[model samples]
Target: MTDASVLEPNAGVTLVPTPNEDDLPRRFSDFATFNEALDYAAQGKRGMNFHDPRGTLKRVYPYSELRDDALDMARRLVAHGIQKGDRVALIAETGPEFAALFCGCVYAGAWPVPLPLPTSFGGKEAYIDQLAVQLASSDPKVLFYPAEIAEMTKAAADRQGCEGITWEDFATGAAPDCALPEAQPDDICYLQYSSGSTRFPHGVAVTHASLLNNLAGHSEGMKIQQSDRCISWLPWYHDMGLVGCFLSLIANQISVDYLKTEDFARRPLAWLDLISRNPGTSCSYSPTFGYDICARRISSQSNVAERFDLSRWRIAGNGADMIRPDVMQGFVNAFAPAGFKASAFLPSYGLAEATLAVTIMPPGEGIRVELVEEERLSGTPRDLSRPARYRAIVNCGKAVKDMAIEIRGESGHVLPDHHIGKVWCKGPSVMVGYFRDPEATEACMQDGWLDTGDMGYLVDGYLFIVGRAKDMIIINGKNHWPQDIEWAVEQLPGFNHGDIAAFSVETETGEESVAVLVHCRVSDPVERQKLHDTIRDKVRSILGHSAIVELVPPRTLPRTSSGKLSRAKAKKQYLSGEIEPIKLAA
Candidate 1:
């Protein structure tokens, strides 16, 4: 490993090393509750910055202001006929408006819900359908959208039989001086919707204290500094964007350069340029596909090598999907000549149920992966010593302070090191429960541990994920799995299964089926057509749905380290035009 000092120049920030893994102090002994921790930051003398490209920068809104704005928003909703605990959906990019609205819900004693920008749908109608489903399930009293989205939001509001309010309209109301309502550490703060990658999303009710505690734990675990800045392109609805990017910055009294999710997709290098131009210790995160896109889309004329200095970037965290080891390396290698440091690649683990972060690899560690036999990792047991092909899977590092992680067997018995099982977590940061789904919630939480539904093992206190338990597709009851389907198609003539992934989806008619999305990896028209049909036929023979194969390019398929396909990431690419779509064999 290189010296932390040596990496500082390339990072463009002063390197402050925390206590080593062996010497670090306890994480949460000082802050008992999330609100207590947030109060500590809110009560601080420092200010916050919500920077935007075209909008005004809110340099410093006192916590008192946040309190007042939240109360005002809450009152406005009530005046519009919303009631306490009524779902209030917010569909805006990350900014003072969204944050204030979320806070307003807290003050109004209503449940605030942050909706992710519509990425799957083409026009306005698909977004309307999505919003309708969320409203039907959540049954929100009111819906709030940014002014730019007002036109489309109206359609959604009309469909849901709910009233819509633009950010401007909400702001016109007088600020409320309503007294701060009493809140329990356990009372719900907001409804965080699921990512909706595989199926219809659910709303997870996160409490004021749960969110705050997770943020506090993230602050300490991530070593977030008060003077730090964050340049983020993550959607506000995603946990990474909401908790990891937004609230973490607020809690640390740091400034954040907030870019719209669309803006980053269109111009990814802008994220790096903004950080370099600002010359602040800034950090941000994205899935493996995001990194691959920037590496592909950002032009060489951008002078990224000379103009951007990544050494100051202390934490280039990767999460929200599987972290790809090669993708991280490729990004570092591509940008290294431009002053980017290798250690900026921070691999992390989290979920919405945990209010975002569960574990974070420390800074300057770069990233590490473990390769164990797939056969040994199968149904029988996790025998690390078995000599199957050892594939490198990225580690999400150790648990934060007060967070305990256990690898448990099917019977809930704790598994030993090198043994894969369900990843269970218990900490102050874990969520209270799933909203309105007591049966589902109970199935996940046992005693204190939250069963993550992910399969992995611990090696030297570091966490390594193998796969998902529920995501497995059981065909013939023999577990017709994702990786196997991808492998089968990748080997077909003219097919690039390395860029091919398979995911199961249920049809509108109600039958469960599978879809295969294959990245073309070729520019020639002849090869592209052959590759598309070849892979599709291969999948059809192996599985049903005759394999809907979308032919994209070499780097199109989303994969994390250990080279496993990320279905959610791949699906997003399919919807975003980064990858081609597929049609089933007629």
Candidate 2:
């Protein structure tokens, strides 16, 4: 990806903030189509604001201007022979051009497929491969991206036999007067390829009604106020960032401030600085790692109170991954002097199949947790002599407005409260199906409810997410969540978040055993061996068995687009010998 800061010349003028108040009354996304929602929001003064690495504002795109550009792009699409349902792939960069093109695809009635930009981890070839796979699945007629990545994006597009155009070049195309197709409520809105989409990808097909319903639920769930603005650094390719922060702000008529995801990687503190300067109450969302990174960046000597003011940060949402309570506590501790309150930490549960939100913690009802024995989580009978061990399961709040959630057992029976089961949800916002993947869609859908593929239980109406059902490591007839092993390893000194990957592997004798790959940073052989032994002993204490522990170089683990560790991919690469462990005899 090109350095946008270098490509786009910065005007040395003060960028005014988009309005926090709109003359048009606030509505919880009642429009039938996203086009209609944008039309309604265009009447408001609120809009999107883009910031630089140091939290300096560079562009302020008002809704009216955005609507104008979108209509022009819509005409251009029509002139370019893009049909009502054609897939238009876009490299989702956090800025105005991508935003306009996305809405433009909507106006022209094309299903806009938002693809991810190259993340900090994956290099050129890996990114090209990733894009090629997703492009094959979505089968878009054309792919659009920044000019900087033309070489790589064009390669991927050529591999998939699709036309690839830079947004800059596409803007210069003919915008002749062409009739735009009218979109209905049930028309397919977009194709969402989830964060982990690769190898066999499933494009979640969502309709306009489904999208609007979800936007409404999330807006009401967060209790959007007149003085609310969103600040985000999450990649727009991910559901939480695309729907929760970007689309939700537009649909709800709230202005937003954005830091490029890569920019945030270079300077995570910029996210907080933008939040601190928000004219109104800040309502931002991120995966747990976002908070963890920000917290870790601020040291004791940083003078938090003097450097920031977070008194009006109304809703600090946590989702898209497991909401680690310890990380949340660490953030609170790091920013408590800056007026950041614990009550602002809102834990929620959601996925791409649900549009975005399945459940959102009610206003001011902060992060809540319940501890249960490891045996209950694993669905194994308790042993007589072993002392009880527990994990803190977070309260993911109740279902968003008009959504119903259920925890079903292995037999597909709805389980009672406090009984662990597979999470299932049904609502108007549920996706239509996976695009061109009926078998995959049928496997997860029962009646109208979507099997969320997440393992969790309910206490009354609130959800307590455990982990992904597919990510659970089972051995000797007992279930073990990969997060348990990963989090336990993270507790060791010299280890941080995303420093370890754990999964079941076949031993030489053909027995399934737990294998952990640690991201070793130490260079000295003696210290490296000591660290490996300590981690091995730690895993032994947790699992009560000797597991395979190998010290790999730092950044060995792969992450999903949302930045969560891809344990399945790690296991695949490790088993395939693609990931060579360091030369440490164990």
Candidate 3:
């Protein structure tokens, strides 16, 4: 695989002609496999472009060149003794090498397991542990990483007792002349590890057919047009990034511009700049925090309309976490001057178990939400004398083609519309099962349906996700979502997204109590106590009860690989004394 660093100069060259006359017609639907989709896309002119931290175009990898390079890498992999059905684990970094290597694995009939790149918050040792754990879970024949992370990768591979080789070294060997093995639709395409929110990450076994079905659904649901292009900074290890942005673009032959995830975190406006600069309609997706960060970054002096032209922005997709209506509205309000429309907000509900998207908000529907009585959300009788509290539930739209969604009660019977219950779905795109973990697989799968472990309701066929069922706080026989408590504390000043985690902790009497962990930066003991009391009071106002508020240092809370706040891990760590709270009283 050619290093993107070598192709940096070609950023100025025009490799493929952008379609100007009309939207390109969909061409790959008839294909049976991902390789077939790539074959069709390679015959076209559209391709993916990579950008540096500063948002400068660094590499232009057209589909045609990508196919040639992938074929070469396929030969090299086979020559190096990577047999069919062998797992080839690759550290997912946004660049040409990973792109080529991933596609090459498909061509070689090998399953590619994408592992997360080391995050800045985790430090080196933590990253090694994470990598080693995932490596052991997948049990890949070999691990591949970029030259930059070779040392860390080697350390992890050695710990897992597996061979590790850099991409450059892996491609250095002689190529075999043998023909590549053909892939069947049911062949395992890759292993996707569910984000760190889970107590234990399970490798999801996704087949080629399942992947293609989801991609086709995404295209159909989005109403893909020739003028549509993608601009994203999402990490490729996660479903939204890998399946939604990277592979979906290839399968659909849509051009894309990528900014590194780290870079986007630093300069989020660069994402908007890419969208503004694109001549075609831009479609981008992000979790609620992404929108919140961008909104907070905007200032009075900044001219949004003059500097950015978001009028062409089409779908501003929201997923990968619980959709916050307030954050979505904040983004629209902040960017409205730049021609960003509220109708462009496309909220969807999905999980990696469903292969990325189970439902997509119908095009042009934007974000339609329903405010239900809080008691209805709790599944208990309402107190009419008390002031009615309302929870804003965003309509996540209908399930995609070939997918069926149901809201099931505790008794395993289907619940009626407007009643909150466990979300279940049956579809062709559903994962076959967890890789080599039938116990985990059987725990979630019942008959042909998957218990999504998420709580939600339906309204005239549209889905409204409430929260993760396991994360629900049960206090005194009533149900409360952790998000409701966390969001309440977030309203306080000096707090930011992901700074709060709410869960239930057991008391000495064996009753569950609401526990809130806050990431605080205040050093003064007086101010820290004030902050803690303020959070407690705010949560009490929302839940009508007191909560145990623990103020920890900043970044103390755990986050998933996809950057979602992990309340489950936070609770475990807090109970285990791993996260020590400040001794304000002392």
Compare the candidates by lDDT and give the number of the best one.
2
In terms of lDDT, the poorest run of 10 residues in model 1 is 1-10
How many clashes does each candidate structure show, in the order listed?
A: 17, 0, 2
Which candidate's TM-score is highest?
A: 2
**Global lDDT scores for all candidate models:** 0.67, 0.90, 0.87
Give the lDDT ranking, best first: 2, 3, 1
**Candidate 1 residue lDDT tens string, 1-586:** 1111111122344422211111212233244343344455454433334434432233444444454455566666666666667788888465667777876676566788887566545347756776777776677878888778787887888888987888777677654334445566677878887675223555788876677677767777778653456777777777788877766655545556666776666667777776675555767787777787777665666666676777678888888776667667778767887778888888889888888888889887878887665454545433345434445668898887678899998788999998878999998768777777788789889986899989889988899877677667643333445765776664555543256677766557766567676655466667567666777677765554464556554565654222336677666666567666543334
TM accuracy, model 2: 0.97
What TM-score would every model get versus the actual structure?
0.78, 0.97, 0.96
Q: Which residue pairs in candidate 3 collide? A: 23-226, 24-226
Q: State candidate 3's TM-score.
A: 0.96
Better of 1 and 2 by TM-score: 2
RMSD of 1: 8.9
Candidate 2 per-residue lDDT, tens place, 1-586, comes to: 1212212433777778788887889888999899999998998888988888999888888888788888888988888889999999999999888988999999999999999988744689889999999999999999999998899999999999999999988887767777899999999999998999978888999899999999999888988889998899989899989988888888899999989999998999889898899878999888888899999999878999998999999999999889999999999999999999999989999999999999999989999999989899888987657778999999999999889999999999999999999999999999989999999999999889999999999887999999999988888999988889999999988888999999999889988899999999998888888888999999988887899998898888888877888998999989998799998644
